[model samples]
Target: MTSEIQSYNFNGASLRTLTDGAGEPWFVAKDACDILGMSNPSMAVTALDKDEVAQIDPKDYLGSENRSNQAVNIVSEPGLYKLIMRSRKPEAKEFQRWVTHEVLPQIRKTGGYIPTSESDSDEDIMARAVL
Candidate 1:
């Protein structure tokens, strides 16, 4: 299967990503794990739900015949969030915000998401006040 992988930078770290047939984004597990300060990518991936993980050949996306046949691990959005929550690093929250507010919107902008009204409601005001 052919796939296009996109790369996003967070605090100078690269998070390589790709979308599935349904247009849902999947993040490179090693990249995310490294950003989140996880020592072992494979071990961290095992903690996520089976449905929240997948394997893909880098050759398919990179189009490099010289690349090895070893499949790379990827995580769904939910799985990424789970890893973020597990992280003890101080910058984890900032990374999460970047992913949600910036990266995801751009990725889904092609077809899947439709934004709601920009008008601020009472709840929005209250939430902002609390922050």
Candidate 2:
């Protein structure tokens, strides 16, 4: 089955994400970098462990208008956390929480995630993050 890009918003910043065949989450590197205020996505991705990053063609995913053969960078969960840790932006912590708390769970449960108005308690969010 082909993967689909799902966009999740954290404080108005959009993060495009997808899952591999193994069900592990991956984020579009540029999208994550943009939200984290990273100026150079390629350089930022280089700082991550080799296993945590990959190059994917747009044709592999649905909802992409890009037909170029050029491969785009994608970061696994660990890489995403690494980027989050490196970020000096004030929103980093909140963005981490949003991902671990909401985005991850929805992706795990339904294979897709996006912005939502529902709010869960910190305790609940933390619990979900642990699972």
Candidate 3:
């Protein structure tokens, strides 16, 4: 399937721009998916509910697919962020193990790291560190 990049808002929150201090962009949905061990939107939602990932709101998009009109807002939780940081294109099984074994435990130990209300998924996490 040809993936389309769309702007997503997380619960009506503000969106963040993805940029590195070095002027580089970070984190794409396809890459994020592989990193988070999520094969679909449902899995992403589940991960968010479990507090295994950081949430983000996609306010605008660059690619053709327009999900801006969808009913549910999309988010990228911390677990997925961790995975994405480790591997921009991680294998499915590898992503799963990292999320279940490493990422989840970290979040639990930290008592959960909630994404800032101003966080945005359309941008790179490292670039939007201030959020």
Candidate 4:
């Protein structure tokens, strides 16, 4: 499958593109963090593993004690895609909360996204949709 990769500025961060067999693009948040040279990108991963972060799947990390959901799939549908695109750089806290709490959960529920797990990585218990 031929795939096209691109980059974009999202929430003051540069994101990387990972495509599926269909060439649809999705961003890997952890990879984005790594590329940005985040000093403590693992901090967020740690929090995710500990369930300290809100709405993130812990299984995204392998061998973490609290591993739960490892993947973070991208939603490609027009409506959901538009919402995510618009919220790329949220200017308000309320909007951020809504996206994190309500909108993202809905997208995950519909399997519109992918996992954060490394390619070919497997999880014993698949992450359950928040909704």
Model 3 misplacement above 4 A: 1-31, 34-37, 49-59, 63-68, 71-77, 81-90, 93-131
Give, for candidate 3, the lowest lDDT window spanning 10 residues: 1-10
Best by the TM-score measure: 2
Local accuracy of candidate 3 as per-residue lDDT tens digits, 50-96:
43432233334433333565332333345445444444344545555
lDDT of 2 at 29: 89
- Candidates 1 and 4 compared by TM-score, better number: 1
Residue lDDT tens for model 1, 1-131: 23877776777898887888887789889899888888899999999999999898777774662266788889998999899888888767787776678657855775333222359786875564455
Model 1 residue 83 CA deviation in Å? 0.6
Single out the weakest 10-residue window by summed lDDT for candidate 1. 109-118
What TM-score would each prediction reach against the true structure?
0.68, 0.69, 0.28, 0.26
Tens digits of per-residue lDDT for model 4 on 12-131? 554545454665554544543343343444343442322122223335322253344554432232322333333333343444465567657865786454333245344522442242
Clashing pairs in 2: none
List candidate 4 stretches off by more than 4 Å: 1-7, 28-69, 77-80, 85-131
